[model samples]
Target: MTELNFPALGRQPTGCPPARGVLVCWLAADGSQVHVGDRLAEVRVADDRFGRRIGWVSALATGTLWHQVRAGEVLTAGAVVGLID
Candidate 1:
């Protein structure tokens, strides 16, 4: 079985409308293969005042994108945006 992990340990965002923005700019474009430690998505969050917040998520293991994500989207903590097979 493949194991998934956080690319970097940081404050995980919670709640609704003011979700953290997710961008897949630093990794392969959607539909490309990747490996563990490879940049998956770069997240820029907003502080209570909606300022700049930062974090990144990388491939936890080598796999294909069972699904794809886009840039400038919002995500909640522990949301599985992609599936690796």
Candidate 2:
């Protein structure tokens, strides 16, 4: 079992494609140990053009980063940001 984090809400960097209204940022460097309730990523939410924070990304279970992800990237449910080793 692996865990993924939600991207934090904030300004979108210039040149980077706007996250489909959502983004995910990993806490660990691609591959790392993850524990329950561990902060994995930050999720950004927007309300009528005004960006707001939804919440912090947490790990569902202990696991490892299976795939590498970059900042300011949109993430969908079960996107497989990483896999537990």
Best by TM-score: 1
Estimate the TM-score of every prediction: 0.61, 0.57
Per-candidate count of clashing residue pairs (backbone under 3 Å): 0, 10
- Where in model 1 is the C-alpha error above 4 Å? 1-19, 24-26
Give candidate 1's TM-score: 0.61
In candidate 1, position 44 carries an lDDT of: 69
What are the lDDT figures for the candidates, one per model?
0.57, 0.58
* Residues 1-85 of candidate 1: C-alpha lDDT, one tens digit per residue: 3433223224445543334455545455556788887766676655565466677776777877544455665565556666567
User: Given candidate 1, what's the lDDT at residue 74?
Assistant: 59
Q: Which ten residues in a row have the lowest lDDT in candidate 2?
A: 2-11
Off by over 4 Å in 2: 3-19, 49-51, 76-78
**What TM-score would candidate 2 get against the native?**
0.57
Quote the lDDT for 21 in model 1: 54
The root-mean-square deviation over C-alpha atoms between each candidate and the true structure, in angstroms, is 4.3, 7.1
